[model samples]
Target: MTQALVDGTVIRGHGVASGHASDSPYPAGTIAMQQPYFAALGLDLTGLYLATINLDIQPAQWRLLQADYTFRALRWTDLHPPEDFSFIHCQLLWQAQRYAGYIYYPHPATKIQHFQSPRMLELVLPWIATISYGARARLIYRAEQIQIEPAALL
Candidate 1:
């Protein structure tokens, strides 16, 4: 796979990705909740963070038209309907360091709630330190997995 990079901002997200909200039913976080399902589908995500890092690619929009792994009709939660998700190989670049990661694409079309912005991408990676919202970061992704339109508005 060809590697490419894009600059984005670490933005505050719905805070539900990790399922850590006080009212959240899943204590381990959503990523953890969905882990078994993905594993069943042959996508093992062991040891990754139980949360997701929200990244906003401003001055551009992105689409996960193709991915390294795609799971459809996943009924991971009982509260909502089924959802589709796609995972693309990527690395999160911060402070001159690269961390193994994946571009977490929970398809809005199949989701019944928590719709994300087109400019946003949910990332899954191992634990990192001192990261905060509004921080600028870079994404090193497989060129064929995600199509980022730099000139696209909003």
Candidate 2:
């Protein structure tokens, strides 16, 4: 176990820029753990959520994460296409007042996702090399249940 202080708070984990397993295709890494851990720590994602990725070779860029967004959003575009991108390290910034979060220069191959419950969020992620980086790792999510009620008639 390792410990580090962030914003005066102590966080105990493996180390800097590590990964966590969440499912078959995603591996456990710092990039994959941030937001979900924040959510588990009680940070709400009901509003806008953004993750920024920077490459060692270029300036940083960001994207707003949506429910139906594709895998491309979390990937490092500049280093992608021919070469596989792997997240070497990153830093996260959050706007609690705006209900927004920012991930700066996430390592290549780092991925993030959202879930409604803590129980369902504990799954492990598979290794990207085995599955290939360009492949889309589909999240298995529970559909929201709808309730029906009697309507008032004239």
Best by lDDT: 1
Which candidate number would show the highest TM-score if scored against the true structure? 1
TM, every model: 0.92, 0.18
lDDT by residue for model 2 (3-93), tens: 1112211122222234333442324444444445345544333332222211111121122222221222432223323211211111222
Q: Give the clash count for each candidate.
A: 2, 22
The global C-alpha lDDT for each of the candidates, from Candidate 1 onward, is 0.85, 0.25
Candidate 1: tens digits of C-alpha lDDT, residues 1-154: 7788899999887777787577766777778889899999998888688689999997788877578899988999888889889999899999998889788888889986678887888899988887889999999987787788875432
List clashing residue pairs in candidate 1: 18-29, 18-30
Clashes of 2: 22
